[model samples]
Target: YIDLYNENHMYWVTADMYFKANQMGLLDPETYTQKNEDYSQKINEGQVFYSSMEWDFDAGNAELSKAGGKDKFVDIPWADTAEFPAWISRASEFGMAARTFVVSSKCDETKMKAIMRLFDFLFSEDGSRTIMNGPKGITWDYDENGVAVLTEDCKQKLKENPDYLLEQGANRYLGLVGQDYDALSATQANEGKYIDLRLNKEYVEENMTDADKDYCDFYGVDVPLEVSTKRENQSTIHEGYINLMPAENPTDIQRSITKISDYLQQAVPDMVFSETQEEYDQKYAQIQAELKNMGYDDVTAYFKEAWENAISNYKELTAK
Candidate 1:
């Protein structure tokens, strides 16, 4: 569960109530069969809030509430919550079943593929357009130029600020199902403009050094060119070499990398979710010892060779 500070109230709570409800077996296949009927009742009863997993950041609340809250709100909860089963309660109260899934880096490829397919169906042209876009010539209309232009008053309201559109149902970019390429491109373009303006003000001085001026000039060309040098260097090295070289002498690079990675992986979960620092340290030492016993020296030599090769290639490339 996560907690947030509401403006009027000191503490407001947010949590993965939907997932929790599903896990508790509050929803079943029978409930799923009557979803629409259930949803209609809930909406009529004013018991439903349109919440989505995409609502990760606090800004999502603004979108959900149509920017109802005051400015400068603070989120209180650091993790998902168990208390307020809002989604589940609404679903059950309205007689709808809920199915929940957790998607993260740890999820297997099969699960990811299934999730992706579900999203694609929901966000496809026909699906989203039918459900979200409202009837023709009403919420949105087409221009003479054949662009999907919102009506004048609606456009004016949205144009009051770009973020207004984004917050209030700009599902084109924020939808879960498909990649909104046009929205993505527009966001990138806007970001580039902001970056260029910031760079012009901060780094583009008349009396700047040649190196600084050259760097600024290069940025004007294309960001990819500047990134290519870094990418080339990275491609030559075993990824493990970067972390291994940071440890003390006689330490194996591969072993050090493994130890550190394992330590961090375990430490984060323990410290954030389960145990105290003392408990984490106890497990961390055992992991380090195991890494050492697993031929850390040989791993270090392999990493060193990779690093040397990378460095040599970088030097040769830069010489030109």
Candidate 2:
């Protein structure tokens, strides 16, 4: 795409242009425009070939709705066999199932009990409701049919402040420390966009709207968690690497990771704009060589050892 443009038209290429070109900002106009006007024009005029993934589907949907369009971004299963041949046949596990919780050693017995109780509550249906929708009569309430519904007041408050629920102390206090996986899972059970199709049978039969059913049909999942669990069970490779604890001596490994990240930041654009396939291959090889020189091997060895130890420990503990 870039080479043909370069040969056919005398397009000015610069460092910034090269970096941003693959993101589909080649003709963003080197001038200022109002943010709203710019986005509306770019989207409505079809100036964007592919929208950036930085925006979640909800955000993208909201933005497009402003210009009288439905959600342009929706979830789709994607697999690249040429780049990841081994992964082609495997059903990769979803990341959300790997929920972990840790209690601070500094906590007393009282605090520990409180934390345990909170965790227990979050596992319950009502607790999940509060985590997701805030207190009754504020963000949500049950209708005559006993189905939970968002209140108009909640919508108004959300319009004024998107973080109204969090600010109003909807979720457990522990959630303030970090993203509470248990709380998050409960919330997903109640109102998760992707998993709404696969809600509990009773909940679905009673609570789902026609629109909700349609959304579920679009995604082809009757139950959100079942789909994730199925993929995880089918996966040949181990899951939850991102959730793993780092090595004790992580400084050198972190440095190497950063170096490789920085190299990719530049090399990706270089490869994309390369004139020929040979040029692209050379750039990729250069990236690999640079990363290898920057202690990539050492970092890999450290993580590999840690992962193996974890597996061994888990097996021993479970066997007992």
Candidate 3:
């Protein structure tokens, strides 16, 4: 999909393969299965890129160990000042662009300094501030103590129910109106004190760029309650049906093996032996239509409608 999309339109193609490759020392098996040929072509074409962010699982494990219990998981420090630059440099040597996720919720002097010269030209202080505070007073605030804070109500609601936060454009950090700074501040205040306690004002001030200051100027807009409610419900479903089952047990592992067997059994008749796209499409469409007729479409439509509405609501909230 990435190569197809990029080839059709010259967009910068980003993939998570670099991190996977770094951690596992190999390409992800799923990626190999889906687009090994295309990936090789893109590598030759110089169209593929890599991104590195906080090493979530590994960092979380480290934090758990430090805390001496599984009761608390730590947030990995933002990648901006971490070893991510070296990883990005390695990817660049392979003729790929490097992108990263930077968060302001936790700012430490050492990490900030490490990233300042390396990523300064690309992200700048303005960009970091924008990402961190989202137009400042609207979505976040500096209290009398000069500590960053989110609106109390927003923080409380999210703590009580995270679905509300995700639904109201809290997790949409890819484009202009991507994240809610106020909500993020609230999250940090509640769950990220470990990071905040380590931040130094001198480092933040010295490293900040004019653009970063500009990003801090705007106030955040409000998101609706309905959006949050729907997100919460979806989150519940995702946790119950998708995340928990696979992560905690071998149910999904067995199911996946079964699926592979079924696909192997079906592939010989469905693709390799078929002479044309028309033949494959005909058979696939027939099966798909049969499944839809058996209530697949109804269930899928319900999920799609909910997802679309949630996105629309988030956009609407962030528009202001």
In model 3, residue pairs whose N, Cα or C atoms come closer than 3 Å (at least 3 residues apart or on different chains), thus clashing, are: 125-212, 126-211, 126-212, 135-218, 138-219, 138-220, 139-220, 164-228
Q: What would the per-residue lDDT of candidate 1 be over residues 6-125, giving only the tens digit for each residue? A: 212212111223223444654332332457666556444434434232223234334434544332222222222323211210101111112223478998989889987875655454
Ranking by TM-score: 2, 1, 3
TM-score quality measure for candidate 2: 0.53
TM-score per prediction, in order, is 0.27, 0.53, 0.23
Cα lDDT of model 2 by residue, 42-88, tens digit: 65555544433424245554566566544354433333222222221
lDDT string for model 3 (143-191, tens) is 7975654546545564566344345443244233222222222234343
Among the numbered candidates, top TM-score falls to 2
Which regions of candidate 1 deviate over 4 angstroms? 1-65, 72-158, 161-277, 295-301
lDDT per model vs. reference: 0.38, 0.50, 0.36
State the TM-score for model 1.
0.27
Kindly report which residue stretches of model 3 are placed more than 4 angstroms away from their true locations once superposed: 1-31, 35-139, 171-174, 177-320
